[model samples]
Target: MTKDELKQRICESVDRRRSQIEGIGDQIMVNPELGFKEFETAKLVANTMEEFGFQTETGLARTGVKAVLKGKNPGPTVALIGELDSLGVADHPMVNPETGAAHACGHNAQIAGLMGAMMAIADTQAGEELAGNVVFLAVPAEEYVEVEFRRDLVKGGEITLLGGKCELIKQGHFDDIDVAMMIHTHSDSTMKKTGVSTSSNGFVSKLIRFVGRAAHSGGSPHLGINALNAAQIAINAMHAQRETFRDSDAIRVHPIITKGGDIVNVVPAEVTMETYVRGRTKEAILDANAKVDRALRAGAMAVGAKVEIETLPGYMPLANDATMVDMFEQNSEELFGEDELTKVGHRTGSTDMGDVSHLIPAIHPMMAGASGPGHSRDWHISDKEMGYLGPAKSLAMMAVDLLYGDAEGAKAVMENHDPLMSKEEYLAFQEGVFRTEVYDGETGTSEVES
Candidate 1:
């Protein structure tokens, strides 16, 4: 079959499974499991993969599911990833009854899309003609949340790392893969589209604990070393450093005081803070982290408080393979109308796919799903027709084109790839760069149970 024929076949396949896929999305949306805890969600996807004849592996990177479809002959291997986690956004009507998780991030749609694409690839005749492989990965814990909970997971060895894809990468999940492609949902009027960005921010998280002496608040306030005061001072210092960060670098530093001592009248003995430092480049993030460390230490010293810093490494900056973008753009134009492919500027978000991109050539495109702002509660997949089918079609078409289409399709994408380092070199660089300190929540400053 020609590339066009395979594309049509895949589109038809997705259409055939539209109702089934939408049902899966609805079930996940209603259940709304949070990051690293997507047990049901993972089961649903893995079961689907097994039914479709893809070789499956579970418990990889702790709740992540990996399935691979090999062609008759070996060629380039491309991976399609689906995130299986949701955000803790408040006020969602379809909230999970027990866990309070909501699929505000529209990852349910992503999984359905991946499943649809996997089905098409499994049923495609191109497998006999093309010498390549397709990988379907349903990753858990992409959304970094509840630092204390994930930190405990790291400590218990349930997972080697925090973020799902990053942990998978560290486990050499993508070592055999060559190219990776996945579509994310964005709130836009257009039914389905592609987003390309030159760069994205690298992020790091830290939990800072301040220890001070407690004393009577009203009677002997002088005897108390105020930990809250130190926290306030640190926040103020972070705000002061904001202007120094370049706009192009897109530096974001936000901190929350998780614990501010016990009683209002009693002098606070201990305080804990959770903070994030994000920047457009790794170098910028590292530099900003150093400055943040200095300011936080200064704040603690001024209040006679001893401070402890525990840092969690996050996703590296996303560098989209331009070659892959071009191939995707051409393929998208062929599948949808030429107008379906639109230019999107840089977005201020992070993903574990960034880690995969660092390992091999990768493309992460944003597909339009809703009409309002992205990641906002107002953001929703109201138009199920467009929201469900469009993402599935785009992802399926990209896979078919890359795997079955003439080498020209894959060649265009590989030509524009700006790979800074080889896969081995990149892995080495990441090993040296990314580090996270796991802390037991039971021994937390304020004693929050793990």
Candidate 2:
């Protein structure tokens, strides 16, 4: 069959299962689960893949699900990804009270759209005409929250890396995939029905703690070193460094105090804080991270307190493959229409897909379907057609365009794409970011590997 004919058949099949697709999205929205803990969501994805005669694998990187649809002959493997975890928005109407998890980021729509594409391709039996495999990936833990819990998981030997895609890469999950693509549902009004960006930022997470001797506030305030004061000093110092950050790097450092003290009546002996240092490039992120760490140490030194800083690896900067993006843009116009695609500049936000992009050719485009501020209580899929079926058609059409005939489209994309980092290099860089340093202010001493 012609490429357009195959895409048409897949789109028809997706349209036929419109109601089912909508239901899946809606059901998942109200029962959201947090990252690494997305058991139910993973189960649903695995069952759905099984229904389409694809033997699925679960428990990948804790709650990831993966299945492949083999074509008539293999040329290049393309991954169509869907994030399985939800943001922790306790106040959201559709939130799961037990988990404080909500689909406020439109991850539910991602899964629904992904399943729609998978169903359409499977239902139409387009694999016979295609030349490469299609990998449907339901990845978990895209949102980098619950850092403490994730750290505990790491210490327990449950998982080494934090982000789902990062951990999966460490586990060798993407070894067979040549290219990766996923559509993120956006609630922004400025976006068109579809949008692609040149790049996005990456980040590293820090868990900081200040320790001091506790003493009665009223009786012996002079005897106790206030940890809260140290934390406040660190925050202000970080703000001061903001002026030094280069605007071209798009550096961002925002810290929050997770714990102040045990009781207000006593001098604060412990203060815990968390922050993410994000930037458009790895070098920028590391530079900002070092400045933040210096500020933390300065704060502890000023107050004669002890500061413990733990740095963990986050996502890498995203570099969307040019050829793959061109293919997606073309398929989007053919499926939706011309004059509807949106071209955007580099984004400052971070995602695990960035890590995958550094390892292989990848695209993380946004599809306009949801409404309301992202990760907020009011965010939801506002347009069923655009939110549910648009991605389905767009993703499937892109796959068809790439895998049809001898798969020249996929070949061209791979030929033109040069991965930003080798797998070993990426892994080493991330592992190197893992560190713990304890600075004692009283003796002016800090211990680390240097």
Q: Which candidate number maximizes TM-score?
A: 2
lDDT of residue 401 for candidate 2: 79
Write the residue-wise lDDT of candidate 2 on 1-450 in tens digits: 788788888888999999999999998998899999999989988998899899998999999999999999978998999999999998998888888999988889899999999999999998999899999999999999999999899999999899999999999999999989999998778877889999999999999999998999999999999999999999999999999999989898889999999998899999999999999999999999999999999899989999999999999988898898888888778877897778888888999999999988899988888888998988989998989898888888888878889989889888998888999999999999999999998888988741
State the displacement of the C-alpha of residue 338, model 2, in Å, after optimal TM-score superposition.
Answer: 1.9
For candidate 2, report its TM-score. 0.98
lDDT of 1 by residue, 7-99 (tens): 788788878888887887777778788888888888998899899876689977768899877766666777888899998877677676677
Which parts of model 2 have CA positions greater than 4 angstroms off? none
lDDT of 2 at 100: 90
Q: State the number of backbone clashes in model 2.
A: 0
lDDT of 2 at 267: 98
